[model samples]
Target: MAAMKKKSVKKKSVNKKTASKSPCKQKLSVSISHDHKLGHDPLAWLSGEEIQSLSKINDTVDPMTFKETKIENEKIHVPGIEAEKNIDQPVALEEMTKDIDDVKASETGSLPGDEDKTQRTNEDDDMLILPEIFGIAQAEDMHGELSSLLAVSGDIEIDASTIETLDASALQLLIAFIKECKSSGRNVIWKKSSAKIDSAASLLNIGTLLEL
Candidate 1:
């Protein structure tokens, strides 16, 4: 009977120790109620004055509207779009030629009265004034004038006082002109003579031939 009582006590103590070693889980009661709100206000922390200030900002600040700028009769080059070419635009050819002519006239240092003087020289065929520089370049033009003078029935008066340079070709042209005048029954009269003319003619041993 004592051994049975001791076994019962040992079993009670073992059960107590096992219960103490095991984990104890408490029951969690979660109850869902329809009285609870679904969505909470995100701006619930903002006061009435702050909310009114935000409303005023929303009313005053306008939403940006992008406007397409229309350009009339102008070419807008876009990156991907091919530009239309107007190939028929007339070139200012006459104006370009006029500009080139003006440039040439300016470079040559021609005066306005030069044309009138040349016209008079051609019309009158009486007096021929030699330029300050008489070169081979001017020989052809001088030949033309001399030929014209030869055609006219008048005594030709030559002014050589302004001749600063006299080329051999020019002296030759003058000699030919004097000879032609003599042959054409036209008198060759000297309106003015210069030492330059005389020296050039003498250097060529043709002073008597030029009647200088």
Candidate 2:
């Protein structure tokens, strides 16, 4: 009987220790009713605010059309050039013809009042210029003009080239000549490679660049 009492005392002590640990451990109270079905509150699940929609659903999102940006004309400026204009922009055919006429007259050292049909006036970016104004000349004549411009402009002179053929003296002279040609409002360009020539040209002083 005494042993039984001691065993009962030990069990009570263990129960007390377990009761003390009840607050630290998770204790759940389940009210098992006659119904064995699961209880669920659909409203409590998420009122559409608590749950975040799953991203990367691979569902096609509506395509978005961005507004087209307006292309602004960029004016290129060269040192010693008074006209600031966008030279790359399209020019009027009639104006270009007139420019050619004027250029012919200037080359002949004709008086400004004495107009020559052999040259025409070319207008680019609101700037007026003259190119040789002959009406649809032969291929040889056109090639001649191109060659003349190349020779006069000294395009063969490459300042930045690694080859010995191109040097600073010749490039400077070419730059000076091209600068004069552009100042005359003549839209002559290097014939070999437009890109290569333009890259070297940008190094020259034309004038203040005007962007329309």
Per-candidate TM-score against the hidden true structure: 0.43, 0.18
lDDT string for model 1 (1-212, tens) is 00111111111111334445762422222222213222222353354232223233212211122122222343445445635633344445654555534553443342332322222222444788887888897776677666656655568889999999978899888988898778767778888999998887778899787876
Give me the displacement of residue 80 in model 1, in angstroms: 43
Q: Mark the regions of model 1 whose C-alpha exceeds 4 Å error after superposition.
A: 1-123
Q: How would you encode candidate 2's per-residue C-alpha lDDT over 74-124 as one tens digit per residue?
A: 565554694655356455466445655456444535222223322212221
lDDT of 2: 0.32
Tell me the whole-model lDDT of each prediction, alpha carbons only.
0.56, 0.32
Best by TM-score: 1
TM-score of 2: 0.18
| Lowest lDDT block of 10, candidate 1 | 1-10
* Model 1: residue 79 alpha-carbon error in angstroms: 39
